[model samples]
Target: MKLHVIVPLCVLFTLTLTQQTPSRDKCVCELTHSEKAFPHDRLSTVEDDASKCNGNITPQKTVELENLLLGLEKRLPQLQQDVSVLEREDDGQLSSVLSLLVVENELLEIKQLINRLNITMLGYQRLTTNTTKELVDLTAEMQELETYDTMQVVKRQNDNRRLRRDLDHCRNGHQPTTQPTEPPHGNCPHGQFQNISGPRVYTAGEYPGSYKYGAWGRDPKPGAGKKSWYWIVFLTSSNKFSNYVRLYSSLSSLIVGVSTPGNVLIHSSNPTTNTVQGPNVVLYGDALYYNCYNRDAVCRFDLSSKAVTTLQLPKGTRFNSKGNFCHLDECYLFTDLDLATDESGVWVIYTTTQDFGNLVLSKVEEPLTLGQTWRTSVYKQGVTNTFMACGVLYATRYVNKVTEEIFYSFDTTTGVEKFNLGISINKMSPNIYALNYSPVDQMLHAYCDSYMVSYKVLFS
Candidate 1:
């Protein structure tokens, strides 16, 4: 009688064991442990286990994720019901309790996931008790992973780098490499931006001068991580030497720097001037580049050198008094007469001849020094265009040539054929003047007498 009972129990146990479970948590745990101990592809045994567990975990896990999302959706209904209850009760304590419960529920759910992940692998899914709410967020998960051990370090590092790169890419949308220069064969070093929400971030209103100062430059230093503020730099017109007579002597080009959200523009105290008119300004390699001699020559203003050095141009170079030329990797010059120099290293785009009634986009082999050079056409455009992100030259036009709101985009690298970005803005009617870019928001700020118009380019 005793033998018979024992045999039946043993058979039942064997049957239960035979029905294997595909445990995602178990697979992750086992796989990660193996990865730490050995290389990845050597995961034959682990793969076999995963294959065996496939009927149980992988697809199941996906279903679980879906269910979790569903649960989150369902949670809203429950919250609405609670909100109804709280609306009836005037007691602040009871209302607070309901809100706390909702938050606590989410915390508990997250904790369960972390607990499961802790037993398995997939690394960053689990966090410690000491970790703050911000630290556990998907956005902050990369930073939190610094506490990982050596075995998991490489995996974490790669994950972090990938996340950082992606974040930067998303934040820097629609911006071009460098500013637009001579079109054909001219190069602008492309830059990718990322969105990094740091702990010390000061919002639009929180940062003092930010509302008034406009945009600034971010620090690209190694460990600036979260504590860096982009310095917003602008020039104040001193109006000390504006007479047409001193065009040869001094023009007050006030260099102003300010910290964002602060209205106080940091002064040199004693305003300064350049020998010639300072038309445009650019920051590169700890130096400022601008047009001197009324935008005829490129002048380098070095913080270290403390003086402006004039770059010798090829003979017979001139700058338009009414217009400004942008920077390419090499630099560029613009004039009305169609002059493009492959050897001259500068390209000329004439608004009259190239576009006629429309806008002209042309590239002269941007003349650096006049020699045997070439000239080419980029776009014979109908819309007025300006340099935005990535030297991705953008163009805009009015439907009847009467509206103040302008719509813009680029179709090709050369003359504007089809570069419509599909984003229309209410802000600008270009006077073909005051079209400048602020690096802070990567916006082309078109300032009129009383207002400035800004447009956003979405380039991921």
Candidate 2:
């Protein structure tokens, strides 16, 4: 085909240089392998070639290709049935829900197709087959999807509409703002979330000076007729254990020490097994959930009955291992699993054997039972910490010894991902292993280098 479009000399020169690069050899090999496998009934041994060409491709790109090939290989047999269903759609053979699912399935396929195209284009000049028409078609399809935020906008819009309707009803049911009184001590509320004004992440120097230091604790939720109360853990006077509990009454006139009845035992079912761990703790109902030290398990300590329940994590889960939870060489102490509490219940974020080192968020349904909540295939090797607030999952990355930022968020309700949080947390200590967000007081509590600090969350 004769080209009629004008091209800048510099652009052409750069393109030529990129094409002549040695990386194109691996791309060409992959493309040729893909073509041979597409026509053959036997599965392609592309993994072998991909392994040999590892240094030539980015790790992310390699993962994308692996997942795409696996999915495509598995779904190839369903393509004919899908086509039949598409044909029968004109005759109304498919239900609305099924049809919507079909659309989603196709969108997923298109997304993988785009990834393949990206790989193919990396070796543009080396391509033996004419891919101009395919490129044009895929580009057009992507443009159509991007106009509406690639299916994410649809879900977000639907969520906003539902929330707006609920808000309208709530406004109609709005009551006078009366200060709620504190319920009697030891009367813990059921598993629930506090009503918050909005979500926020306070930057350094922006947090109010009201929150005190010298304590590491679970994020407090509104309960027991009180708007905010924290379960602060402290070491006993003997320095042999950290099983003492203190309450930080946000509403009380006094902001000093207030001891509670129950003391948390830092041992497992066997009295000899010490389960003392740090940073992450969740308050749900009358039970406090935290990961057991050196054990791949979450421990639920009951305040009323003084009973302990241990929920074991999946096999291959990291725990108490050196260099397990570190983003870089600067490692934090004893961070294996992160426990968080939202409006509804408690959740634990940890890696599983099935997720290939990716983060999995599972809901704590019972004291010992964990319900699978959500899983993202994106690897969290760069994540320094994770916490849940208002059903949304936020992750932080270590920028330096002095700074960290909330670099990622996943909205469980809408399944949306955000990457543009510029909010920064200034740390006095080089190691900050623990982070939790309190909905009732709208604060992010952090345990940094043995010092406890609270940052006020300011909503935009």
What would the per-residue lDDT of candidate 1 be over residues 1-460, giving only the tens digit for each residue?
9999999999999988877755556433443353233334434544554454344433224333333343344444545655665566647786778766655554454454344434433432332222334334432543444334456777878899999999999878867676522222123332331111111111221232222212222222212221223222332333111111000000000011112233222123323333323222333333433444343454455544555565543334444433322222211222122221111122223343323323333332222232232222333233333433443334444343223223343323443433333444343222322234433344444322212233332323
lDDT of 2 by residue, 117-174 (tens): 4665566434323344444555565455445454477679889999999998898778
Predicted structure with the largest TM-score when compared to the true one: 2
lDDT of candidates 1 onward, in order: 0.35, 0.55
- State model 1's lDDT: 0.35
Candidate 1 lDDT for residue 416: 42
- Using Cα atoms with residue i matched to residue i, what is each candidate's TM-score against the true structure? 0.32, 0.48
What candidate 1 gets wrong by more than 4 Å, as runs, is 1-279, 312-385, 396-422, 428-455
RMSD of each: 28.1, 30.7
